[model samples]
Target: MSLRQTVAKYFTNHAETRERHDDPALVSHYYKTTKDKAMAKLEEMFSDQQLYDLNAISKEHGEISVYTKKGRKVFIIVTVIMVRPFQTAIDFSVTSESALPFDFGHSNKIIQQLYAQIDQHFTPLDRN
Candidate 1:
């Protein structure tokens, strides 16, 4: 992560992952699965989590919205994009709900944990 990103991650209540994120771990993740399968797996995974509540799911659009059920309370959006046949890229956005204006990197931590679970659930393509 760059100096700006590293500072902002701790100073803000929101953090997101994308295709070209400066942090290698936060880069968009590619999975060896079709969109339909990926969406299904994500839905199942999120729904099965005790800390997460399935807010909404749009298989057609490939977006899943969820909220934390305990602790600091947070909103998370998971996006799955099909780059090619059997190749899907997934990203995450997390926002911490707080009046203090910052969650002290909690949002980024949420994304990292979510990504870790996703990686464990699916076969990831080459990160490079």
Candidate 2:
């Protein structure tokens, strides 16, 4: 990633955890599971009505949209993809609802928190 890209990520209100991200921790995490199971788990997790409120989910497209229950009022979208028979990848896109031009990496932190929760529930695969 370029210097501008790295700098922008910290200042922007939006951050996305994707494949080959500049920060390895922000990269899309691979899990040992089928896409169906991944999606189901995500749905069940968010439906608990704790930190997040489930907005919409598209199992066919492997996408889930949600909002934080409090603090910064973030909008987050999680995407789950099946890369192989039993290997799946999960990604997060987060945006903070704020009037400020920047969020001071709060969005990135939200992604990290989401990843941590996922790690608790899923068997993570080594990134290759």
Candidate 3:
């Protein structure tokens, strides 16, 4: 295998692209809106990115799973947990599917891109 593939394999075996962020501001916004509405907005956001096969939408659990394609297939899981009335925690897990052993950080790039899109689409009301 190539060096890039070898390194990717090692890292994939040891680590994964799992990220968590707590956005009280987002929770506050969500609290003002209904869960179904929030889910619809999220679905729209994902669909805007051209994600496909979005399934397993659990409103009670505040979780959604979707798939997208770049050079390879990418699976994304998004979870929005209401910590309190105005506190929310979001988690993202991105995985890349490739025949080769290495993805050259494609999964991480996907997560970053997703985050950027979210921030762009949903700018926090409270900047401070």
Candidate 4:
């Protein structure tokens, strides 16, 4: 494995990171969707995986307090906002539940996968 992978494997216990994306097409869709509806959609997206302690903080923010299936507990916060007409931004904050200093890149992977899934399902607007 590479040096980065080695350190991630040996020295990390938890990880945290954030991602931001702008989706012009999703503004109206998100505005029309309720927080409960969004949370349900997220739950459905991860239905095949294990999740727990999921909560929607508001129409614009949601949190997942625990994810146990991955061996380490993970906490995730998702925020959605409308920046302008037909423009929406989504942000995600993910943190691992371990006491150790390293997270083995787990949190990064989670955010990547989430963005991939959301992009695939929702289809962002083309930049051109």
Candidate 5:
């Protein structure tokens, strides 16, 4: 198998967004779904490679200035993990963030945006 597959099989999908805060069922479902997708991606990328070194590359914190109709505060955190590849000699970033909104709607958007950016950045490295 591959390292990515190994990670996917064990990855957690649950997301803790502000929108699902009130509903336990919805929150649980969100978490599982995200976890499953994330794990699948990891398994695809890292299953076979030896863990040469797995370490935190960097963590950046900043605010995204997206002015919506309702002013919502967003706490933007970006995490990067660097891995040493035994097979191809590559490095990549696995980024994630907590999109919590003081209100309700924007959190979902933030999470989706964050995931999309990470996916776009990482998908190519895994393919090669």
Candidate 6:
């Protein structure tokens, strides 16, 4: 399948529901409304080039990968950053964990940390 199709499917599959999951829509909504705003004020955000390097691939959106970590399949998704400084959202999920049994806390944390890491990597460019 094409990248766009893949991304769309992924988002649809993980769409938020009343039940609980790594709903991409819900997560995106939260980021766009809150995180995106806070990030906008920062002198440096994530640039598209940086995102591609971090993800180790070329794509306009994000990439999702699943791996076995400590005997559990962890879903690791790396999203491209459309902003400026060098930020990308990295999300992950493990079917075994339960602290956030109702939602995607772990994944969100990973994604946030990834963004911070990327943000730190870049030397802020002038804002003129």
TM-score of each: 0.94, 0.92, 0.64, 0.57, 0.28, 0.31
Kindly list the per-residue Cα lDDT of model 5 for residues 1-128, writing each as its tens digit.
46763354234322233322342311211111232334344343333334312222121211111112223433332222222232111112122223521233344444555454444534324322
Per-residue CA lDDT of candidate 6, range 7-30, in tens?
A: 553332232112123433224211
Residue range 46-126, candidate 2, lDDT tens digits: 998578899999999999999988778899999999999999999998889888988988988888887888889889999
- Could you arrange the candidates by lDDT from highest to lowest? 2, 1, 3, 4, 6, 5
Query: What is the overall TM-score of model 1 with all chains considered together?
Result: 0.94
Candidate 1 positional error at 87, Å: 0.7
Clashes of 6: 9
Q: Which segments of candidate 4 are over 4 A away from where they belong? A: 1-40, 43-49, 60-70, 126-128
Q: Give the whole-model CA lDDT for all candidates, comma-separated.
A: 0.88, 0.89, 0.56, 0.54, 0.30, 0.34
Give lDDT tens digits, candidate 4, residues 14-116. Answer: 3333232232211222333444555556666665555545544454355434354556677776665544554544556666777777676676676667767
**In the order shown, what is each candidate's alpha-carbon RMSD?**
1.2, 1.5, 7.1, 6.8, 16.0, 12.7
The CA-based lDDT of model 2 is what? Answer: 0.89
Query: Of 1 and 6, which scores higher on lDDT?
Result: 1
Candidate 3, position 3, lDDT? 73
Tell how far residue 10 is off in model 3, in angstroms. 8.3
The top-ranked prediction according to TM-score is 1
